[model samples]
Target: MSGHDLPRLGSLAWEPALDRPDLLAAPVLAALTAWAEQDERVRTQVAVAPIDPDHADTATLNAVHGLPTEASANCVVVAGRRGDDERVAAVVVRATTRADVNTRVRRLLDVRKASFLAHERAVAESGMEHGGITPLGVPAGWRVLADARVAEPGTLALIGSGVRRSKLLLPGDLLAAAPGVEVVEDLATAIDA
Candidate 1:
């Protein structure tokens, strides 16, 4: 599909992700392929577009793409341990907010403490780039917690496509309803943009 057929978001030239698997990281491609067959929204609405890897950071991306920071979502990896077992979760929040890792995340994981996963470990475990880990293809054992604000009506989530070279854009409800996603209230605290 060409840019004309893709969902319009920001100023990027969007294209159908399934038609340009090269724009997606391996796990992301696989997840999309599967979800397309299982969910109508995934097949019809998800779109991808190339981006400058150097500008993949949320602030830079929003600035370059002419999107409000609230239109973008950030995914972060967190890990906590209880005894010898560890629980890992991918928390998604609007770019203007921060995940409550110290209390909410730790409580959600039922562990005494939760911390952001090391960049290297996150990249290695998720099989995605350091700045482009997304909730869509995170390991099945890990939880995906999207802050409720992200699923509010009229929001479009600009998220990593598991690679720094491209981004995925879709309605927030699509992400909220994606398989294994849990919408949690007050999961993140808003920060000034």
Candidate 2:
């Protein structure tokens, strides 16, 4: 089946992954592209879309593109410090749920406190746009913590392609198995609509 044949992605205007020069320019995205090329599971499953950089945020993107909230996922960079050492993780959760940073994340990192990484720090460290820090190509040694929901088979997760101008759509299980990624339960708490 063609990439567009993937469920939940047929509605979006997806361009061939190799054709997106804008996405390949970003270091993190470039890394992801290389990784996908090497991994058959990801090479056949991923799709990319060029979007308005301004609407990259989940709420606006969903409203404008008519995508379901559940199909979109958010990648948040979280940091915790233990004395001289710092631990960083990219937390992936569905847009409908918020990462449990204070409790679950802190416990996982074994740090006294856990909080979202500062915007500048996140961008500088990941070498990606602020609104597009995906877990796929974060700095080596950083943990990628994906919520269990993101790993459910057949779930199409809309996530950042490491740039605000584009997004990636792929099977949740594929993302969960990305290099150094860990699928954790209760990583996020559902928000009441």
Candidate 3:
């Protein structure tokens, strides 16, 4: 994508707070922030904001919390063995839609079958509390997959802070900050609300 094609998040309507806690300051956010800072191309287009922890879900999280849904999106990381194989991979899917792990993801990851990582294992492996896991700060040796839709220029994404007390609004460029994230075109299939 051309530099001009990149969406400058400042154009979007988002609020910033001087007193608000830094969502990226947490382990997850810190890791991601460091990564962005290390890359000039990514640092230029990235931004972060704090949100209420209760607003974790995309549907009601924004309404009661009084935030812009357009600026918030969900992040889900799934890890498990294939159908009958022992291979394990982490799949990241957006909250606006569910990951088609049962079909699309399993095939894309080239695993026999896949399932959500157990609560204990997820938190343990990610070193993040449940409800606060972001693609950032994940331990080394794990695979990262992002929804292609997230790659759309100017898109803002809601990610966890490694803690359940807050969230961060980061530029979509974060999708590129990770080491091995693949933007899958059909990773997420819409579900009936």
TM-score of 1: 0.95
**Predictions ranked by lDDT, top down?**
1, 2, 3
Residue-by-residue lDDT tens digits, candidate 2, 1-193? 3444533453567864555656643665666667766676555567788888999999899988899899899999999999999999999999999999999999999999999999999988888888988887788878999999988887888989888888888888878877788999999999987
- In terms of lDDT, the best-performing candidate is 1
Per TM-score, the best of the predicted structures is: 1
Model 2 spans > 4 angstroms off: 1-11
Task: Provide the overall lDDT of each model, using Cα atoms, as 2-decimal numbers.
Answer: 0.89, 0.83, 0.60
**lDDT per residue (tens digit) for residues 103-186 in model 3:** 887787677657777879878877787777777667666667777766566566665656665665555665645666677788
C-alpha TM-score for every candidate:
0.95, 0.92, 0.74
Query: Where does candidate 1 have its weakest 10-residue lDDT segment?
Result: 1-10
Which lDDT tens digits does candidate 1 get at residues 1-193?
3214346678898877888899999999998888888876676678899999999999898888898888889999999999999999999999889999998889999999899999999999999998899999899999999999988866788899999999998888888988889999999998965
Candidates 2 and 3 compared by lDDT, better number: 2
Q: lDDT at 173 for candidate 1?
A: 80
